[model samples]
Target: MNHKVVSLFAGAGGLDLGFQMAGGYDLLWANDNDPDAVSTYKANLGNHAVLGDIREISSEEIPECDVVLGGFPCQGFSLANTGRRADDARNVLYLEMLRVVASKRPKAFVAENVKGLMLMSKGEVLRRIVADFEELGYDVQWKILNAADYGVPQRRERVFIVGTRHDLEVDFEFPTPTHGRKPDSGKLPWVSVGHALGGLPDPDSRHDLTNHTYSKYKLRFNGYMGHRAIDPELPAPTVTGRGDNKGGVVVLHHPSNERRMSVRELALVQSFPLNFEFACNQSAAYRLIGNAVAPSVGRSVAQSLQQALKTAKVAVKGD
Candidate 1:
């Protein structure tokens, strides 16, 4: 059975695309406040994505679905945001996700956030979040997953919290790493930046690639976030929305160390399809791509959920 899904805080539809690629998900509805992200999502994914703040939209407006998916705003829970605080107003956004799950009562729900969430307030924040879901009778589980482990060329790590309705009697298992730093017997080596961006033409030269443009921000090797040079032999570092201390868009140094990776290249590293178009300007495109959950990682998680649900269905039939 194809599971209907309602996506909240759906930035550029990366996670939604992954669920679609997994083949058993139907994106019934999606909501995001960013106009540019909504435009890009509509252009490439579908017209279901709506632009509006989740807080203003009532649960009655959202469609009922088998699953709920969201990667809520993570800046307040991100270590990179030096000003991260337990009291940051944005940190409470997850409660909005919770509010929906409580109202919709989907069979399963998935929430994603920055890795810092696990460490926030000495892990108290995560504990409270889990407890809140459990209060709604869900068997909740959460883990930190690295994007590179699931074929993304970047080593981005994020926390995924999965909850299955208690009555469903299903345990959601996180997907195993298919690629690793040191490949054992069956695993593949981590995809390198060079491998992911192998055939792309230079941004300076004429190219037909969508969003094949780079930021003109001067290279600064001051050992800050976006200024460091990328090693072609290894996975690229996490793509971030902010660059430097001044909060400009992050444009990581190309593997060549001569220039920053073009928007297309960064999107490629995030495992977005080459044909996927960002309907926004260069800076906005960079921010959207940076803030997105890598499509490859999302696919892995979706596939795992599919297996677990199938298994539970079979068990229920037998009973």
Candidate 2:
């Protein structure tokens, strides 16, 4: 039987998809606020996607599940942008997950956020998040994981927290690094911009504003050629809401080509399935993609969780 999971703040179902790939979990419910994200999630995840803001949804309204997945808003806790003062409302949303955990009491959960969360508010914020989860009766294990370490092309780093209900009492372990070993890195292969966007329309030629294009990688020899490469070896760079617009630094098409990465390419780099279509408009697509958790990472954690559950089940049977 597939393990059941309820996902919150589920953007584009990336986390859910990863867990599914790991071979045991079936998403019982998924939540997201953006219409575009919701649409994409629904299309990809089917009936599980709850198209609305998570805060407005009641815990009782959700179905039962073995695990809960969430990647809450990070603006207030993110170090990349300024204005994360003591009073940002977004920072407090972590409490929302706490509230849901108290009510739903899933067997386990995996929460993700920007790596800066580790040092936010000089670490006080992270401390609070841990304490809050513990208070809700969970044993939490967290680590800074880079997409690069996991074989993604991007160099994005994130903080992942895995927690089990106090009753479970099972210590969670992060996945071992898959890349960077001797043979793999004997000559460390860096998946550069060329690998990410090698042949696409010119970023300038493509006027699709809905895509939210971010920064494109510059070609070393031909700065004017707008070509981006796809490095399959390293973890992919962080997929952001602005990947389509070339707003943030991104792997662009050949400089002369002008087209930024299409939404499908972004999803692929983020480890989404090729057939998995983003259900929203271009801008909405960026938002969902940017906020999504890499499925590969999620699948790794899910595999670990599934093993723990099986071990628990076996112990109970023996007893």
Candidate 3:
């Protein structure tokens, strides 16, 4: 963890943790508006997080860093919500990210969002986002990356936008997945819900595992809950950020038990370490876990960025 990084919309510090796990990143500053998320981040990731709305923060107040990263709000662009549109007010938060990168003028910048972003306004939103970075003097590259492909047990698909400063003379290369569905070509098989949540104490067992407790809300008989009774052998479905107040969408059943997966199990499925404490009520915990970018996926991208920067430095020395 050597390079300085400023993270925005850093919900529960999932993306920042991944960059740390990948090594070569020093999380210097992080900002998030959610109180619970900020508490969790400061507790686990250190005191770097500032609780506030990004639109209120002046870029000059933020320190210069090697990279600026954000998993901007995707609620307005996620498929789970039909009202998603390019003009949705939340969609403009990427401009906040753009503001950070433009302010820091870092060597590189990374932005992640729901996979739906690729199809937003028939690709106009995506084009504009990339073009925004280009306007700030970066060479941008983007792709839809699956969490399952990065060793997470959940099948989360996110679009990563990488921008390298033109002076770096190096193109940012997205990381190749270390694991995939087939386990061929030297790749490992996709990790399963069983692999992530197996052997944990039953939700009723009252295990002391952090955030592993069951929610107070009983399962409804209605059709809102999608993908219950998960297959132990396959990757779990995407975790949604919505809470039970909206009749909760992610109701994961235990592979061996009758009860649904606990909050800890859900976190594990998202590739979060067991010891990583998520601070909040049971439902808020779920929302934070669901909203998180898988750390394993973040690490994969961070490692790639490190290599790309190293290559650029070496090339410069050669010249």
lDDT tens digits, residue span 91-176, model 2: 78777788887887778888999887877778888888898898888888888987656656566689999888777567567886
Clashing pairs in 3: 1-24, 1-25
Per-candidate clashes come to 0, 59, 2
* 10 Cα displacement, candidate 2 (Å): 0.4
Residue 312 lDDT (model 1) = 58
**What is the lDDT of every predicted structure here?**
0.89, 0.68, 0.84
Cα TM-score of candidate 3: 0.93
Could you give the candidate ranking by lDDT, starting with the highest?
1, 3, 2
For model 1, residues 213-290, the per-residue Cα lDDT tens digits are 887778877777988878899999999987543324487888888888888999999999999999988888889998
Which residue pairs show backbone clashes in model 1?
none
In terms of lDDT, model 1 sits at 0.89
Off by over 4 Å in 1: 244-249, 313-319
Which candidate order results from sorting by TM-score in descending order? 1, 3, 2
